[model samples]
Target: MVAIWLDGRMRPSTAASVLVISARQVQRLLRRYRESGAGAIRHGLRGRPSNNRIDCGVRDYALAIVRETYADFGPTLAAEKLAERHGLTVSSETLRKWMIDDGLWKNRAQRRNFHPPRLRREHCGELVQIDGSDHRWFEDRSPACTLLVFIDDATGQLMQMRFVPSESTFSYFEALEGYLKDHGRPAAFYSDKHSIFRVSKTEARTGHGMTQFGRALAELNIEILCANSSQAKGRVERANRTLQDRLVKELRLAGISDRAEANAWLPTFIEQHNAHFARVPARPKNLHRPVNEPASRLRDILCWRDERYVGNNLTVSYERKRLILEDSDLARSAVGHYVETYAFADGRVDLRWKGVSLPYRMFDKDQQRVTHAAIADNKRLSEVLAYAMEMQKAAPPKMPRTGKQRTRYEPTGLRSPGPKSLLAKRAERRVAEAAAQAVE
Candidate 1:
């Protein structure tokens, strides 16, 4: 269009129309092309660096921090940390480009998925998604264990987390206790169809068709919802994935190997994690209800409870152990009545009748299995088996028998052995005489 206009073969208006610009723009470009000879078509700032580009020293510092502290963090998270912690004001996209150029990060191809996204709850504590992740959290430093995660559905905040051996009822009980004390009771708990939360069998002859965990939640007036699939409880499942990546590294950095130390350090990590990842609730109001129940009542509700009938001797058999109730007026009247037995996670058992604790002496019917207080789940099966083998090796060898054992023999058929007593001899002689008379 400019060439036609320069050659005077076409009008500026026609050239402007062809070039998709105004006539004035065509005239301006034509004059510039006359002066600069096609060089004027290039942008003036093409070869210059961006004025808003980050300084070299700042970029170096940010990259150093990423390498040193957050090498595995995603670009967005790394950018956030760079700004918040190191005062490097870089955008996530810019940081991602830089990381890609530096070979510190890679861009992954996006994949289509079938699970639809669910909206967050309206208020905090409206729903808490609970899950247990079995991971080698401590790497090879310690035995693998399960981490119980309690995440709020409304805000995507981690309510509580604990390192346990397995996803057992007792482990959940302990985690629930901590959650109750820390954040009070949530309206409902969201979880999978684990036996701890739901009775999987339809014909299960257990406590009113509810699991121990379900019963405990019912006692606390907290509803338990079991998701049909893992994607249904995706909040906690995703949290587990994040923890398996970040928490494991955190534990490694902190030199923590055991559950006790990991537990102690968990609060700090949770606070930090929530600060970065937690989202604002849709509603400002907190939905968590205060725990109005007394500590004792709460303790009772959170324990493993079973019913046993008191015998005529005022004794109750539990787990093959006899509990002899003290002879009292209450005990005497308790005979033939049903009593409740509460077993706490801390290994304490309380026998109660009509909400009153009964005094009793335990007569152990069998020795209990050797158990470790720190261990909780099957993640440590290998360690437990190794320990058992070691114990067996350390045990004293059994003594060998010295002499052959004798076997008692009896006379065959109707023939009798020689009698040792006078009464036996008389009986034998009478039998023989009767036999001889019959023969004659």
Candidate 2:
């Protein structure tokens, strides 16, 4: 995005140069601006306003047509439909903006950044990002399915792999179980705000609680972190995209497609992939160690949702509804039905009551209601994009058509102080947009 922005306008090429971009970029930006105006310069489509956006009425009528007829169509196809039916024409980009403005566009959920997601984790294995991508990973060789991927944030190691339908606690469990069986436990697991990792309404945490996945990590003495921004976990996500492209071919070439066969073939893929792509760490191998728990006990750590509650004394009360109801003999006291405060390996708290989970909360005995000391979440980018289109605060001061004096041009928000620096202005906005995109 920044590269596109810095293209075209001329800037010095010195160390003191405000924009350290290439000359070709300047020409491109200039061509775009000339063709599309400031919109082009801002990376928007350049050219005359779409003939379809001829007037507010046409725009409205076109939108109405879209909402009623081709509502489900993607922007490009919808634009074509508008031209064919209403004889109103507009570029897909223009239609997209109109739909976005009207809140009719799809809202893809994005996992955000660190609690303070800073740079890469300070030490190898300090933060291991785990995520799953549902894709045609085997290309035409196999049916589409999800690949569970665990990547070490510090060293960029592809630590573990598994195949599943959708990314779920069970899939993650099976993968993490394998990881633990091999590499042991890391300091923490980094992930997106998936329901398993997040405190959601469906399974609210006890005033003191933890999610099931969080509980497992806590049991293994590992921390759990959900990124504040999706890009914050770019290590795993970027890897997912890369693998979807590369690994799919490798699988196809090897003539592997069946799910079980794919899974069987993954060990060979991992070894070859790691050998070619893995990097030497700035630090040595991580200090992770396996849990010394018995096999049965370790398997218990991989469970999904289980009924639990808090005791009257504020202690976690739990019962077994699964196979080993009598394994601990504690289920005798816990069953008929009871609750337990779920302790996550990452150390969060989850309180389940009457078979339903509640949101994590902090309560003041006096106030007696739930409260979150931390802010809920950040605002949506669509809100800011909408705000970007607000009309000027006051009517445009008309240039006197009657003016005999040569016109003196004044730049609006596009200029920097003390001098005309279109180059620097573009650079500033370019950087700003990049930062905003990183968070989204």
Candidate 3:
């Protein structure tokens, strides 16, 4: 602009408009340019220190106090403490820069790890991200619980959500069952490499090669994807953060602290949430496929399905319970072979031979006591402790039993029943809807 004005092509007022300065300032700049050339364009106080800078002595004292007493304190807290105790008032940012120069603190750029962003899926149901966030949702009104979240990657929709005691296999099973019933089978489920989703132990000899949840998805013809890092499943991880803020407030507003009540009312919240936040997909298509299998089949698939070797006397030992198969041709046939066991969420176990249910009688079905040497995995420690407490409440005072009876567990197995299976509840709801439609 100065060059333009010097060339006589622009009026002083025009220069003022272009430079966002007063016409008087433009005129002064023109005079300065003619007298001193390009150097006149720089501010008069370009290299001078600010009049607002603190005294050298004061800055030195502040740095000395910070280094001597509050070396580990953050900038904000240090500022507060300086003002309260030492009668010194320095802005947090100013002190932050000083600390950075003194090697007392790392800058934000140096402190944070960068994660590159990934594009969302093109269709709503093409990739559904799932996660379990363990938090204190009730704010002292109730014990902390885990919230299982299912969110669509493309639309950012809250496809499904439920509260459970913890992030266990059965908890995920219940949540997955609800999601399947509501939105059908998504093309794939993206999740963190949790043991429930992926086999964390590579050399373990259990569950063959896949987890129970993985096997269930295989049966449903859906893909289970494990993210290498938490940032990889950023969709559901971010959703968990948002829900920790918004859902907790909503629960407080409704005075709902119980998991059961919150679950019953979550559909309304989900609808409102989707209305406010869910977006249109890049491609206007939903990739979710309808569930072709019956509810019973889904129930069997979702439950804990493990194969056990049948003994010589047609007996199967499961969770320390001796399941003696009723004397029959099928039971005798399975005696020397492996029979599949379906452990339902409702604590019912079914022994099947090649997809055929075999009747059995429970003998010596007493709960196994948890021993001191029993290595409870970190994932299930809370549940194991809770079971131990419950067993202690009902157990009679007696000397420690010898032999295999040292660790008797409660009747409710290690992973006890969570909320009843949503399968039956959803089926009843569908039937009621059909009945109402027929009446109308």
Estimated TM-score for each candidate: 0.61, 0.47, 0.66
Q: How do the candidates rank by lDDT, highest first?
A: 3, 1, 2
How displaced is residue 373 in candidate 1, in Å?
23
Q: What is the per-residue lDDT of model 3 for residues 1-440, given as tens digits with 9 covering 90 to 100?
A: 88887789988888899889999999888889889998998998889988888888887888899999999999999999999999999999988988898888897889998889999999989999998888899989998888999999999999999999888889889998899889898999998888888888889876578888898899999999999889999889889999999999999999998999999999999999999999999999889999999988888888998888899998998998888999998789888899999999899999999889999999995677777788876756776788788878878646875666636654654675677678988998999999999999
Global fold similarity of model 1 (TM-score): 0.61
Higher TM-score: candidate 1 or 2? Answer: 1
lDDT, candidate 3, equals: 0.89
Q: Poorest 10 consecutive residues of model 3 by lDDT? A: 404-413
Q: Relative to the unseen true structure, what is the C-alpha lDDT of residue 421 in candidate 1, on a scale of 0 to 100?
A: 93
Model 2 residue 288 lDDT score: 82
Model 2 quality (TM-score): 0.47
Q: For model 1, how does the per-residue alpha-carbon lDDT over 1-440 read when each residue is reduced to its tens digit?
A: 67777888999988888879899988888888999988897667899988877788988888889989999999999999988987888999998988888889987743234688889899999999999888899999997888999999999999999998777788899999999999998999999877778777888765688988999999889999989889989999989999999999999999999999999999999999999999999899998888999987888888899999999988898876888999999888889999989999887889888888899998774434334554533545654666566766776545766666546454467865564898888999999999999999
Best by TM-score: 3
**Candidate with better TM-score, 2 vs 3:** 3
Clashing pairs in 1: 165-377, 166-377
Q: Write the per-residue lDDT of candidate 2 for residues 1-440, one digit (tens) a residue.
A: 43443453434343124456665665676568677776665634455576544688978998898899988887889999888877888999989888877766764442232355456665667789988787877776655677889988777778898887556566678788889887887898889887778766645545336677787888889999888778879899989988988888887788887778888888888888888877766667676876798996785577654554434333333332211221223433444545545544343445444434444334321211112342222222222233333422223433546655457765576745487489998999999999999999
lDDT winner between 1 and 2, please give it: 1
Alpha carbon deviation, residue 301, candidate 2 (Å):
1.4
* Per-candidate local distance difference test: 0.87, 0.68, 0.89
